[model samples]
Target: MTSSARPRRRRRDRDRGTYSVETAVLAPVMISLLLLMVAFGRVVDAEGAVDAAARAAARAASLERDATSAESEAQSAAVRSLETEGVTCRTSSVVIDTGGYALDVGVDATVTATISCATPLSDIGLPGLPGSKTLTASWTSPIDTYRGRQ
Candidate 1:
């Protein structure tokens, strides 16, 4: 047998199972990376939902003329915003400040809304992560000086 033929036979045997071995080593890494990305994406989406909820609720409360109506409107707006964005929270709270209603219309007054949302990360069950994360956001809207006051 020629030396070249012997070398060629050795090379073929060495490479025979390389692809299968590489796949076995790389498959888990790729899958883990994919799972991590999904978890991160979900958290980012929840962050956006919380921001939108705070803004919507604050705006709704600012538009109301009375504290009673403002609180109700803010809570409703926050829930609607979260539901529309497909973000599920284990606990949700909304606090509305309608101090602007008592101030003179010409005075600078602002309505503030604070929202707290606790979301469960256990639903995804990613490794080395906590069970839940809480997100809180506050937004303020200025009352228009020219607008009628209750």
Candidate 2:
């Protein structure tokens, strides 16, 4: 090889390893960001499911005359809705108050999710991470309307 060609060949060899180094530095950051996005999406989905369940339960309670049955129906609705959305419903609570001529329905749901990533650097250890999301929603409707008093 000519003397000038030798320098050009050496430069190409140096540049060849740079791409790998850059990829190594950037890959973990990208992966972590993607995982965060996925986690956030799951949280949002859980919240939406909980909200829908609470609405359904509240509607049922407004129509029904029995408070005990209304609460049970509310809890069941919340659990079933969350499970259908691929999130495990760890616990659920529902409260219905029929005092003051209005019925108030409240629901709280605890949901857990498992997220896995390709690299350990992006692995937010499942136990310590915020893997569970708690969502609550409440609805108030006039009970007297159903009873025909008002």
- Top model number, lDDT: 1
**lDDT for model 2:** 0.54
Model 2: how far is 33 from its true place, Å?
1.3
Query: Where is model 2 more than 4 Å wrong at Cα?
Result: 100-128, 144-150
Quote model 2's TM-score: 0.68
Q: What is the lDDT of candidate 1?
A: 0.88
Sliding window of 10 residues with minimal summed lDDT for model 2 = 110-119
Residue 144 displacement (Å), model 1: 2.6
* Model 1 collision count: 0
Q: Give the clashing residue pairs of candidate 2, or none.
A: none
RMSD in angstroms between candidate 2 and the native structure over all alpha carbons = 8.3
Q: Which one is best on TM-score? A: 1
Per-residue lDDT tens digits of candidate 1, residues 1-150?
Answer: 698799999999989999999999999888878878888888888999998999999999888887788889999999999999999999989998899988877888888999899988886656777788899989998878767778
lDDT of 2 at 83: 60
